[model samples]
Target: MSTVSTHVLDTALGRPAQGVPVRLSWITDDEVVVLGTGSTDDDGRVTELAPDGLEFGTYQLWFGVAAYAITSGQSIFFPEVTVTFQINDERHYHVPLLLSPFAYSTYRGS
Candidate 1:
């Protein structure tokens, strides 16, 4: 069984993106199944997006940025961000997002 997690950092504000909504989904051959949903904590971390454990396949992490932008009083080009990745083993997967109002990036982490 694999575990998945994520964190979001606001590059413009130089702080954790607290209260941001996040959703996890498993992509199957025929459909997408929602695994879990959560909001980032004060530390901008959703430490367990998949409490039920993850399988070896493609999955998506969808982040809701519009609400964050509204609260921060910033205009963003992308209201939402979705990252798709493949899980191949029983190791832990950490996906961290570096975000600004108009731009965002993600990378695999330990």
Candidate 2:
């Protein structure tokens, strides 16, 4: 089984992106399956989008940014972001995002 998590940071504001809504999905050649969804905490971490004993498959993470940026008083061009990755091993996957209106980055974390 595999586990998945994520953390989001607001680079422009130099702080955690709190209250950002995220949707976790399982993706395949055929279609996408919704795994779970949650909002980031004060620390911008969503550590448990799925239950324990997660299954291995291709997964997609969608983050809502327009509302978040607007509420935070920043104008944003990209409203939503999608990240697709494969989770095949029995280890845990932490997908971290450093984001701003003009740029964003992601990686497979610890």
Candidate 3:
């Protein structure tokens, strides 16, 4: 079993990207199964996407950025972002997003 979490930062604003919607899903050969959905809190963290343990497989984290861009009064080139990762062990997976209106970055964190 494994666990996953995420954090979002608004690079342009120099603050946490609060209330950004996120979706957690599992991907298989034929279909995608949604595991959970949440939004970033005041700290820009969704620390419990899946309250239960996650099994080994391919997973995708989708972030909704259009609303965030509108709220920030900026035009965004990419309205959404998706990060796909594989789970191969029983460890904590921390995926952090460094985001702006036109660009974003993500990395496997501690």
Candidate 4:
């Protein structure tokens, strides 16, 4: 089984994006199944989206940028960011989001 983890960073502020809501979902052919939900900690990390691990399939991480923006007082163009990825192995997957008001980037992390 595979495990998933994530963190968010505000590039404009150069700090961890605390209190950002996040969701994990497993995607099927017809519907999306929510796996877990949590908000980022003080260090901007959600260490356990799927605590029991996962099967090889497609998954998504949903970030609530609008909520974060509202409280952080930052104007954001993208209200939310959804990243879809495939899990084909039994290794740990770290998906990190580098975010700004106008743009964001994500990459597979170690």
Write down the TM-score of every candidate: 0.97, 0.94, 0.96, 0.98
lDDT of 3 by residue, 1-110 (tens): 89999999999899999888999999999999999999999999999888897999999999998878877787888899999999999999999999987799999999
Model 2 gets an lDDT of 0.89
Residue-level lDDT of model 4, residues 44-78, one tens digit each, is 99999889999999999999999989978999999
Candidate 2 per-residue lDDT, tens place, 1-110, comes to 88888999999999999988999998878998898999999999998899764677888999998768977898877888899998777998999988898888999999
For every candidate in turn, the CA RMSD to the true structure comes to 0.7, 1.1, 0.8, 0.6
Residue 20's lDDT in candidate 3:
88
State each candidate's clash count: 0, 0, 0, 0
**Ten-residue region with minimum lDDT total, candidate 3:** 67-76
Between candidates 2 and 4, which one is better according to TM-score?
4
**Native-to-model Cα distance after best TM-score fit, residue 17 in candidate 1, in Å:** 0.4
Whole-model lDDT per candidate:
0.93, 0.89, 0.93, 0.96
lDDT of 2 at 58: 81
C-alpha displacement of 49 in model 3, angstroms?
A: 1.0
Question: Which digits, one per residue and each the tens of the lDDT, describe model 1 over residues 58-94?
Answer: 9999999988888878898899999999999999999
Worst lDDT 10-window in candidate 1: 67-76
Poorest 10 consecutive residues of model 4 by lDDT? 64-73
With candidate 4 superimposed using the best TM-score fit, by how many Å does residue 99's alpha carbon deviate from the native?
A: 0.7
